[model samples]
Target: MAAEKKTAIPKDIVALSFEQALAELEAIVARLEGGQVDLEESIGIYERGALLKAHCEAKLQAAQTKVDRIVVGADGGLKTESAEIG
Candidate 1:
């Protein structure tokens, strides 16, 4: 069996809000696409960008889970359900 691969997230990255992480990721992409960074720097930023992307995905998934759980009942009361959300 293959062990799951997990990147070690930097402490600073863990503290960043979703927006901050995304902005940094965008900048990394721009640098890579512009071909301004040297090979070493490009590799470094690409790794960071991967971490940022994963962080953003985790944040969005948490938000989606919360949103999916809440529903307004027929009686106009708010409740949570595990059922599939349309």
Candidate 2:
């Protein structure tokens, strides 16, 4: 079972929702930090964590693109500007 888990690839990792990916990533971090796994398993989980981190970052970037900032215009009216959140 452990060998199968190491060999399995999360093909849907990229398709996972932001919350789902984040939760899985957090779990991986906790498991890795627990110091119970050997080096090989640690490397496998670390790779998965990297993918999860990328997915979360992409989700955040996509959400940021849709975010708009409200600013006061010269005519004393509210205007919207594309806000970039890094």
Candidate 3:
């Protein structure tokens, strides 16, 4: 049988939400671990997974930057402080 051509991942990878990207990455890992794909296909999926992982991380970092913690001032006033994300 002839080898099948590997298809590219769908468009707008960076546009995917953090959850979406993470889910896709998880699926890629499962597929890779399953060991059913040919080497070339595996390479393609691995590349896609890398992109997804990076996108997810960026989304998370952006979200972290927006997160804030409420603090009480000495005078009992409320203040918003950026939360540190590790």
The lDDT values for all models are: 0.83, 0.82, 0.78
Q: Top model by TM-score, which number?
A: 1
TM-score of each: 0.67, 0.61, 0.60
Candidate 2 stretches with Cα past 4 Å from truth are: 1-10, 64-86
Per-residue CA lDDT of model 1 for 41-76, tens digit only, reads: 999898888888887878887764444477899999
84 Cα displacement, candidate 3 (Å): 18
56 Cα displacement, candidate 1 (Å): 0.6
RMSD of each: 6.1, 8.9, 9.0
Find the 10 residues in a row with the least total lDDT in model 1.
Answer: 1-10
Off by over 4 Å in 1: 1-5, 64-86
When 1 and 2 are scored with lDDT, the better candidate is 1
Q: After superposition, how far is residue 60 of candidate 2 from its true place, in Å?
A: 0.1
57-83 in candidate 3: lDDT tens per residue? 667766533779999999999999989
For model 2, the run of ten residues with the poorest summed lDDT: 1-10
**Model 2, span 18-45: residue lDDT tens:** 9999999999999999999899999989
